[model samples]
Target: MNDSADVSTSPDAPPVTIFGPDFPFAYDDWISHPSGIGAIGPEAYGQEVAIIGAGMAGMVAAYELMKIGLRPVVYEPNRIGGRLRSEPFVPGEPEVAELGGMRFPISSSSFYHYVNKFGLRTRPFPNPLTEAAGSTVVDMNGESLYARTLEDLPEIYAEIAAAWDNALERIAGFSQMQDAIARRDAPEIKRRWNQLVHDWDDRSFYDFLSTSDEFGKLSFRHRELFGQVGFGTGGWDSDFSNSMLEILRVVLTNCDTDQHLIVGGAEQVPRRLWSDTPYRITHWPVGTSLSSLHNGSPRAGVKAIRRADADHLEVVDSYGVAKQYKAVIVTCQAWLLTTEIDCEESLLSMDLWMALDRTRYMQSSKTFVMTDRPFWRDVDPATGREVMSMTLTDRLTRGTYLFDNGPDRPGVICLSYTWMTDSLKMLPHPVERRVELALRALDNIYPEVDIKSHIVGRPITVSWEADPSFLGAFKGSLPGHYRYNTRMYGHFIQDDLPAHQRGLFLAGDDVAFMPAWVEGAVQSGLNSVWGVMHHFGGQTPVDNPGPGDVYADIGPIDVGD
Candidate 1:
């Protein structure tokens, strides 16, 4: 009973270089595939599968499992959606602030599938000075410049953008890599991407920028300004110390472009999945949902996971309630396995433990204030310019976004989305103090605009590093962490894992090729679904290839090489 499904490639198949540089993975292929990812026999059907965390990954896994005729009991201590949290400033109003993941790229097809299927509306996220964002103000060292378009910036800014483009072309074969990625040509992608991994895995992003001949020719001031007015979002100075591979993935996959924000809130995706009845299988009725399976409430947070027997695993909740399941999937942050939960040392191998323990998470803090109206849109009487613009600065308040809910309704303004040291600076402060500091910073950038007067409701703030469940904002792989990442990312395929270790699976953005994106979480969940199905003596349809199947044919980037 070989669970592995072999996929054959035609000898005459053309080289895969057509898909454009967005992430080449085709999740849409499987989601719409008939017969789904192989079904389990009647005996394995309806069996309880324990899923930890009710976040996007866990919920996505649970939803798919239910459709495949398995009961997935999810345990979550905090609210649903995990890092996709969107907190409301005023209760029962559409005016809300994204405390976690705010924007999503159009390239994340897997995530958009659920978004589109669930009937969720989305609007273009105003990243810096994008058209939808209206205008942008870049403030640096007591100086401010407003730009409605990239051309509006000084000529030097154009030079910086070109230097970055040339640097990528020179170092990473930008065009070929993008073409390979677009066409889903695994061989070309692996060849080009692996060369980057091998060369840049040990290099810091800052090092790559500084050493590039294109950037090296520019004055240091130009480099500083480049960091101040970064592409896509805002300043990326915080990511300077991270592995260059991380930045390349974001840029290459288009994760930083054509982004959109969920209209109502991102929380709606997981919240809807909790109770939405899309498909029924086996014991569950036509309208059976995840909530119905759990008796309308998620189980308490998992406290520990232990090997109850060779065939099953024991999971202990925060309340000391222990439950046994034939299979378990751990979708919580990787660090939670050691920091928050007291799991048996034997649950994961020493190597796996090293990967999980060594995982680095970048700290992030955000403060959002609700304004009476979209006051930032107001024009100055004397200056004849916008009083204030969606701001990017080197000050304490790093990036600011304005969410206009129209003229009359209240609007939300994300005063800051600070990372690393900046995030740490505000960790000890309270929300009001944080808001005050942000206001003071804004005041320096917009002395003419009285922003405080427009603020209506109490400001909301979050330091993701302070959250017990999530030890940090998201996985921030450092230089030389490629091997560790490969191990964790490939954990879904457990064919080589010992029988005792085969039941417990891992899935999340942290265990994905692209962390800090909802699509990564969704793709990881789908990978876990295939693995879980394979473990239960299931097989994938011939027309539909699972991740493992694809990986077998075209292996992951051998970064260790």
Candidate 2:
């Protein structure tokens, strides 16, 4: 989906992965090391640790904690996978609607470590302008244009793409920073990225584009086109108000390019991690797993958390049962601390609470339908082109995707995927009405194709903001929120913290430098694992220091209050 000119790397250059410019640590390498993440003292064996959610972050923490000889008592209000939800269109069927976290970039090595551990296969996601998509159609202002590649598009689109590339190179030093990340040069990454943080922290993505000399020279229509069909993905006008640093981190880390989709569903990674036995585990017997320890299911939803004593914290579930633990890991959305749970104020410092409260979440919606066959692959006799394509448009149904199962199996179509304002418009609509509105929008594009005639069964839809369990989809940091992110991300390093906040830990994408990505969730989870281990008098093998072990040297820069 990238519209930028293909900047080819040297044939011998190392492939870029999400080795952070913020905290240039090799989480993927650390986890894969044979020595294991770390070890706790024998006294900590079988000790209980409360985990507040069953999402990827919580599951990763729980799995690792179980491996290191601790009992992880998981509590989930809903299903196993949080935003990695994959709902079967028809009950018991293999086909599913990925309601959240559908596309995963290859640079997410930390996340892929677990996916490979569980043996989950992956295929190229059908993103616009990609080979997997086959073709793409861009529709705006009552005009439609189809393209198989960037070269096939009109000259105006090419000019807009060039303008974007020029802006990144001139304003952000895009290539130099990416080269440092690919080479794993920590000092260079810090030197380059810290400057970006200092300069762009208070600026919005739109601000960056509007002020760039390259974009300034172009017409307003060019900027609008860039927003509607952004590089490496679809529309990003929704993120125009977010911090420029946030957008820069995404591109520098390659979070938007060369993505893949889990074969069954993204949810399988967390679900399998919960049940899969580790090859090497301490204290627990062979074949022991997080599932076996919990009797095949996690505990009920947590209702409150409070400090019970100097040595322990107490967790009360929705069922009114109370349990005490020396360590607790909270992996839910930060907002839930204020809305859903009755958390003790004294559990955290006032500054930390402010960060949690200030964190903003973006709204997202997806609508999907199953069809009798892959009718979209059929070529139109009159136009000599496929009846439809991966679509990006200004209509209410902002983006539409087609999923082809085999020739005999039923096909799936994501009728619409929208964010922010576009998503809010669908918030009041039901699944039937969502499908109706999406169909109406598509009919305007493909009037000759009878899309409704090929429908097979019921449709599926989700609005993340509507769910009380998750107020919104994921974190989208606004301008001037870098300090808040810094505060939340560094909370795991509790050495300077007062006694009251010592044993509690936070881990999730929202608490990471790169939010709305699975790698961030996984890396943050590992940080909590290190924090919990240290809390119980544990240490990483001297050969493999944890994120906390190297925190003072390579942690994220403090951009000041």
Candidate 3:
């Protein structure tokens, strides 16, 4: 559903972008600055920096580092784009399934910077209660309610929405903090947010809801309904055990509201970043792109990482080729450090290692099928409502979204998008089995629709937790994990770090305060860019200081040991 307390969208009101409550740096402004990201000395020009994983974070770091004269040697075991994966149902066809990050929030300004740079198009995602979805179906405990908007739903849905809004305002000062963020008030944001970090870092999202007086005034069923059909997006019960601060950040920054889907697929952003040449590159010649720099492909998957010397780090690829560089940016999941790669213990301190090892990642599963046409749009004569709609249910198919390419063209439907326990239920099942289960669930909601008749191609499915490269879908900080997030997010600023940990920098959505968002990945990549540049004595332009330059004054708060 949509957040009832969303900021005013009027022309005069300041837009609510992801200007952080933590860090509070304007990454979009930094990247779009006329002076460019930064400049490195001539000594650092053409020096190779190893970047592991060709994901959004990896590609962004590679692209920016390449633009600033450094040669970024990228390594990837899987396909590029990482979680921004878009798989086509038919080879060379426009019909595709976004298996990874399908939704993009307008507040993710840094990510949109790259999207705008690549000229990728976007339209509002078909979220549960959004206009783009046209209609929504919320099925709870065997009852189904169809709504063109939140108002069309039962009175209880509105009560849940109001209760959530009241809780946020009463407990979190939602509007004031959002206003601070909108105005780019760093000091005010830090003041308000650091307090929240201190207070809510150890609490769970469920704890925040259950303990709130507003929610407590209502029945347990109200809370259950709230969890099943949550504000901004759909159900968030999967994240109930997650740190309240994490959920707070999402709503405060508007990460869940006003989200859009990248037209064609979200994967196009990174692919374009890989191939497109920047118009304002520094030391690189005209038409030089990451594609050209690596001769049209990245290096093989990284096998291990070790300290070659006090001043350099060595990376070994799957092909057994080992190379030492002054700097390396690892944009892969932090869990991979222990599982996928044979990383040396001395590369990081025990505290940092604990942070990395203790990091918890949530599981996710999605199943999609391409249909002959958008038959769901056809209206039902008896009810005068669409045959089916963007669905949210307590059944196995927790969320079902429709993608209408065109009336004539084949349409794609994400039959199921589930997380945590629901996702685990489908992990052992194959694509066909997963599709069967999702169809079974959907059948209960739309008994007369005959959905199977419209299906044209084989269904696609993915369980990110099953992937060796990505141990889980994305980082979901548990209660009291804020210290770990602080440790990871601040690792880029290495002046205080020991020599062993200095050259190896971390960048990814997982490393960011706002994990599972592309903006987090993009910002983390930019932070690593600044770290890598500074490792070689590079300096940002005076007019456009980098994140590292302002980090000490406004970095993420240290919750505790």
Report the Cα lDDT for residue 48, model 3: 96
**What tens-digit string does per-residue lDDT give for candidate 1 at 1-561?**
000110112465332221212134577567767757667778888898999998999999999888888899899998889998989877888888899998988777778888998899999998886888888888888889989888898888888888888888889887667656656776778777767777888999999999999999999987897777778787778889889988888877667777899998999999998989876455578889898888899999999999999888999999999999988999999999988888888877898899989989989999999988998788889878878788889999989888888998898899998999999999999999999999999888888778899988788999999999998899988998888888887888888888778888999999876889888888888878888888888777887777777765555665444
Please rank every candidate by lDDT, starting with the best.
3, 2, 1
What are the lDDT figures for the candidates, one per model?
Answer: 0.83, 0.91, 0.91
Write one digit per residue (lDDT tens) for candidate 2, span 154-241. Answer: 8888887788788888888888888888889999999999999899999999999999888899999888988898767777799999
Ranking by TM-score: 3, 2, 1
TM-score against native, each model: 0.95, 0.99, 0.99
Candidate 3 lDDT by residue in tens digits, 1-561: 555555656678788998988899999999899999889889779999999999999999999999999999999998889999999989888788999999999999999999988788899998888889999988999999888888998998888888889989988999889888988999999999999988898899999989999889889999999888886689889999999999999999899998999988899999998999888887899899999998998899999999998888999999899999999999999999999999999988898899999999999999999999999999999989889999999999999999999998999999999999999999999999988999999999999999999999889999999999998999999988988888899899999887778899999999999999999999999999999999999999999999999998998876655
Deviation in Å, model 3, residue 552 alpha carbon? 0.9
Q: Residue 477 in candidate 3 has what lDDT?
A: 94
lDDT of 2: 0.91
* Model 1, C-alpha of 423: deviation from truth (Å): 0.6
The list of candidate 2 runs beyond 4 A from truth reads: 3-11
Superposed by TM-score, candidate 2 places the C-alpha of residue 9 at a distance from the truth, in angstroms, of 4.6
Model 1: residues >4 Å from true position, as ranges? Answer: 1-24, 280-283, 559-561
